[model samples]
Target chain A: MATSTPTPDTPAGPTPTEARHRRIGELFWSSDPNELRPWEERFTLSATLLLLLLLLGSPATVPTTLLAVTGLVARDLLHRTWFWMAVAATFPLGLLRMSWLAWDNHHFLLLYWIVAIAITRLAAEPDEQLRRSARLLLGLTFLFATLWKLGTPDFRSGEFFAYLTVSDPRIANVLVALGLQDGTVVPTLAAELRQLEPGADAALPIAPGVWRVAELLAWATIAVEGAIAALYLAPLTSRWRWLRDAALVAFVLVTYPVAPVSGFGWLLVSMGLMATSLTGRRRTTLYLGAFLAIAVFTERNAVRNAIEQVLSLLPGVG
Target chain B: MGAIGRFTGLVAPLALVLVAVLQVWGVTQHDLSQWKGGGFGMFSTVDANANRVLDVRLVTEEGAFPLTPAELVGVAPQGTGRFVSGTLTLPTDDRLDRIAELAERSAWYLDEQGAATSDPSSASPQLEVQAVEVTVYRPVPDRADQRLRFEPIAHRRLESPA
Candidate 1:
């Protein structure tokens, strides 16, 4: 009895396929088959442009900026055919600026977008794929980083952070709080340091509580990184998935205040929020605000000033 | 997405993961330096039984000018690229070629760092660097403080025009 009647087996609402198609249709932009929201496109372009500009302009020697600019123009302002050109060029351009690329641990985050852009050109439904790749990259990065840190005895002993706190200018402000300066002698390592010629090497004594601080920090780093890894690996149906992401956002806010890896935090924030569909709009917006806020506060010059201000408040250290 | 397109999307992440895995494997074998590409071996050498530090300087008729290895490669100071060390000496094919290459690079880094006044118009005496010297220092390994001694395990010298 084919009477133009719906089957009893039919669901009351739209089928899964219909719902997915409707969603994709809503996000469709341009004549291309790829499905990325207009906002996602704009955000990706802005992030790439800003990241390249900051990298190239600040250092003064990165010639890759010109390549990146060409790629950006070709991809965004030109035909869809040129999108592949932009994507193809980013890798070599990145290689040409290998010095900057290898400068920091977090620089690998930039490659996430580079690969995502390339995937967008190849896929019909690009947003999900792009976001999936990003999430996977972030997870992989954290997992490997966690493993690397775990493998290092120095890191486990907190000595690595101690060395960084003592030597690296980026986190040197912590010294002021220790009631010492960059080159003060640590009592424990003082004798060996004294054996060397006076000016040949600068050795500093760890502040009384620096080791404990470093130890806690080391453990905290491992913990947070592991949690982030779990976030990406968690099943889509897991009830606790959102908690892990919130923890990551909080970790970024708290840790970046001290270490202040500006670009690193910024990239993480952007990538962390890319799973908007899975994470939901409100949480994504929250992370975006957190990212922008952290980015603004951690501007290189601003970070230096903030460090200087904190140091000046210390007694006799100013 | 077509099956081929879907397959390509999968390839991107898999490729990244593969590279990362290969990098990790290479690092465990100590065959890869982990400097050029995204590798997870950063700080892996912190616990090395022995650590080597390279100190390079350009010696001139006037005085010695301190410079970093990165400067030798025409890059601004990036600290050390890796923990690995190699002996560079005269008559060694690759080492000599490297020295010659660096000599051809502009030494304006000295002027940029304000180590010397190289103004052509100024009447002040110019710092004329005559040769480059590289010294490698290794930790005693069993030392209590991990102090690096002044004695160098390897040294290289290359004469330059200026």
Candidate 2:
């Protein structure tokens, strides 16, 4: 309950606006050990950490690398408007140079989030602006994703996941362990698919069992993504508001482990963290856990390995 | 909030709209993959890089020879991989021109095996590239067989400078 009123020593003391600015600056830049940091401050730190992780993980283009090193050296620079403007500006420049060749969809997500954070820093009510922006962006992301999946015939027919299971080694391992396809089928199918000439009338054989599992996965993905989108876009006063955090956290936990794109997962969690109520300790803890979970998932196939270990313990399974 | 702050607040939402519009435009007009350019279409479609291929060939006075991986690496040493990737993602006229320009500017020679080489010392016969042809192929599932086939979605050919 801090007041923005000027004190009796107003002649010598800073004006209310200056005082407020200093307080906001302290919220971001201060490193006092004893001072209790609020959730907003903590959110900013988490976002900065997420940005640093992105810059480090991405191709070491000059601008991104320089931004990463500078932010690391002077951590406080992350709080500055000019610094974020440079950051927000760097992404488009990178996109122009790299174009579609190298950038993933999540790179665009990262850019949007960075832009939101940059704009938030310039606002009088940064926390409010950030929350609104985060919710809107997250909602739009899933909406577009769901729409794309629905529009694409391949996705609806489960061809995408079926092909991915046989092709992508990471996904193939998981599916193979789940008994969707025998271990031998992956390499053989993949080889045949690779060797098949473009526009050739030849079709690769897919086991009926694998096709069913892929269809199930495709539908499940749609359901979950659609649910998350609906929940995030729901009105603030609606009963659905409380469930947004749970849905997002669950999405992160379930999606990142198998997919293993931790940068995208981390960015989602950061946005979820921003959108949630700061007053709830449990919500904050849940987000922090999600962050750590993404790190663990990215560092190694912890969840997949653990699943495999469990499957090995089961009878007639390995 | 001041006017600038208010305007700044709108930037994120406006950008979201702009991205969605551009992504759709790309998908419909340029045959840009759904999974790229801020569409959030990742994991939604198999139409990504894995399903796309770029076939580049250098048409010389004698015959058309496939541009070897080595030649591609040699031409744009710094950005060869990305250049190839960019062409596959969205094979616009500009990107094709750039690729053709790179090939035309660099000197190519044929070795004893008649394979093109960028090195002068390996030259058995000097070769002049007449044009560069780049075709972008994408996998499209055949309805009858349910098997994926590569179809040439876009093709670009640029004549070399005299």
Candidate 3:
């Protein structure tokens, strides 16, 4: 019996190869290619109208800075790496007013964003340097985060004990009564903090048997965070990639929900995390999109306030 | 010494100046001179509300108002950018020391408490305990340094009680 050669493993139905081939078009890995389509031309129109309004109404700084950033981001989207880097580096110099920062360690600490931008600018080429700098950033952030929390008693415990006496008794009860809510309390660090400050409010009221659970979870975080720091340095170890990615997502969940929108530091962190997906191994677009949406909704007022203040600084604008 | 040595000498000061300028340009800049007790004070500015208020840069402790001796007399003070008229009184002798001591205090306090102790209706220079009185035009702008011109209004001193 003669056996016929089977067709290349096909789907259940006859698929149109030509249509499929044609549909597999050039990928816009970074920008939304949909932005170019004529159907959604309103963004372009609105942007143009806003540009005109900004030019006519606001002072030089407001309209000029907005125009510059918009132009630079647009230009860089095409192929202007050097121009992008230069503009990004010079942005804070032009846009930041000394009055905006709170006078303290925070004022200087916030300069890290500029430094990160400079590092990125200096090393931007063929995506390798960008990845390397991103790695460096990851390493620095994770290493410091772990080291700062691991040795200290406060890290595992979530500082709820110190915060127990607040007007909201539930949290205090969690800290004082439930022996650090099983989910809330990391076992090891809380135990350590309670040990250090025995009479202090850090002690969770519960059976001694339950305390080990907190300790176990705390050690896990330590191991995981340490692993992340190492994995960031180890570039070849892709196995722990999930851990690192999950930790970053977890970080967003924990930080953004709690960090105040009034603070620029946290916003910078969120922006950076989103920006990193550009060169990062972890594909994190949804989290970033959510952040952008939040900014457009919840924190829109603050953004509007900043834009208005900048506009008001102009000579003729009311 | 030699040609290279001459070149080195010529380049060092220039290099120092360049570094100083770069240092200034590199960081987030505050033009305010943070040097304690060194910066000059400015008197006040006209707000959008058209009210006159002090604009003391604690960093720079100079009155923004006209500071020149010529402007200290009964002349109209000009160019401080207060957008309002200010009466600047020049103190002499014991009063001069008093003015300096008062100015050494915080500018905000000094602003709420302005300089001239005596009103225009007060006695002339000889008996008048208060310093000289002259009009102030504008407070100083951030643009540049300025000094006011003062002219003597009266040569007579205040009369003593009979």
Candidate 4:
């Protein structure tokens, strides 16, 4: 075997502490070769504990703070980035678990808001890849949502009559118990075709030409969905962004009753889109808008309450 | 093979883990000869006293109906995860009993593909379902589901009941 060469500073060899520090520094913390030092055990332990909390699906404020401190320490010593990764990994889970208890998923607001910030910072990078990824994700979310909703016949048929009929049991119980969920005495939207007695149709009170408007809305939704699908591959230009934002808003405005909160998210997205359009700065403003929208909706539905409802329903789920 | 190959090897486990999580998302049980679906995932640990075991499957129909929820009350502090939720479709409970006995005797890793493999005590077992807490998961939201409530056990002994 070839003889090992010693550094000029230490002709014999590195001391135990030096060797250990060097090994640890090289293995875990930083990428720099000349520098070598063990990470503070407190930081390491905090990170480990935070990781454990994530696995256990019981992230708390204490663990969150510990992780933030760890990230700062890591930045100071390692010069490598892990702040976003730590947040991304642990935060979403914490919110999801909290949502499981609360019967709402508002906890996601905290994570999504931070995601917006990260997206803004990342938007500045010269590589065009993140921009592409963001574009794809936006399209994917809408497409999946569309496909999922479409796959449900009741959803497409606007037969939320079952849900609405049962929303208030005292009003609906007698009719539903009779197996007549449709509150209407007649299928006026069907057989008679919109012309009923002088009074407003309780199920649908529309303007004189509203049937045409309703039909147009259906086609408009389909076209907007198609546009969103195309926008994913379309160049990341200002015009496409405007169209996308407008289409999303239109979708929310149109699909008012199905999922009101999603529309709320689009409304906030619209404001940010407008701001981003005006300044063309694109990073901080976009994130702020997206997060603000998500936060607004989610907080309305607390995490713990949502989780409780979801979990409680799970035992006899079928 | 150098750093790249080593990097791929490291990533393999992570990829497997991610796929497993996705599988959890896609988890549905089929009633071998029976039929069903429509429940979310839940977990329960063995009280460790009864040494009881549960075998279950999560499944639903192709036309999975959207959940109609009621005013959600709240989430529970602790629930099932250590146990697999499944059912048996048999003329008798003998096979189920045998399977549960075998399952309790030694853990087996069963994937969605239905492939099972045995590992020694020292081996890192992937599927170690220990408890079977049979529960009713309410799928609709219009009504609040009733649960079998019990007082919290401070320190329940792990020994088997006579």
Q: In order, what DockQ does each candidate have?
A: 0.22, 0.45, 0.02, 0.02
Which candidate's DockQ is highest? 2
Runs of candidate 3 with Cα error greater than 4 angstroms are: A1-64, A72-78, A94-96, A99-124, A151-161, A164-228, A261-284, A289-318, B1-162
DockQ of 4: 0.02
Q: Give the fraction of true interface contacts kept by model 2.
A: 0.64
Which fraction of the native contacts appears in each prediction?
0.25, 0.64, 0.00, 0.00
Q: Which residue pairs clash in candidate 2?
A: A198-B150, A199-B150
TM-score of each: 0.60, 0.77, 0.37, 0.36
Of the candidates numbered 1 and 3, which has the greater TM-score value?
1
Q: 1 or 3: which has the higher lDDT?
A: 1
**Which candidate wins on TM-score?**
2
Q: How far does residue A63 in candidate 3 sit from its true spot (Å)?
A: 8.4
Best by lDDT: 2
Q: Is candidate 2 or candidate 3 better by TM-score?
A: 2
Task: Give per-residue CA lDDT, model 4, range A43-127, as digits (tens).
Answer: 2222332333233233445555566556545544212235644565656554445322231211322233334323333333311
The better-scoring model by TM-score among 1 and 2 is 2
Deviation of model 1 at B106, angstroms: 15
> Model 1 chain A: which ten-residue window has the lowest total lDDT?
A25-34
Ranking by lDDT, best first?
A: 2, 1, 4, 3
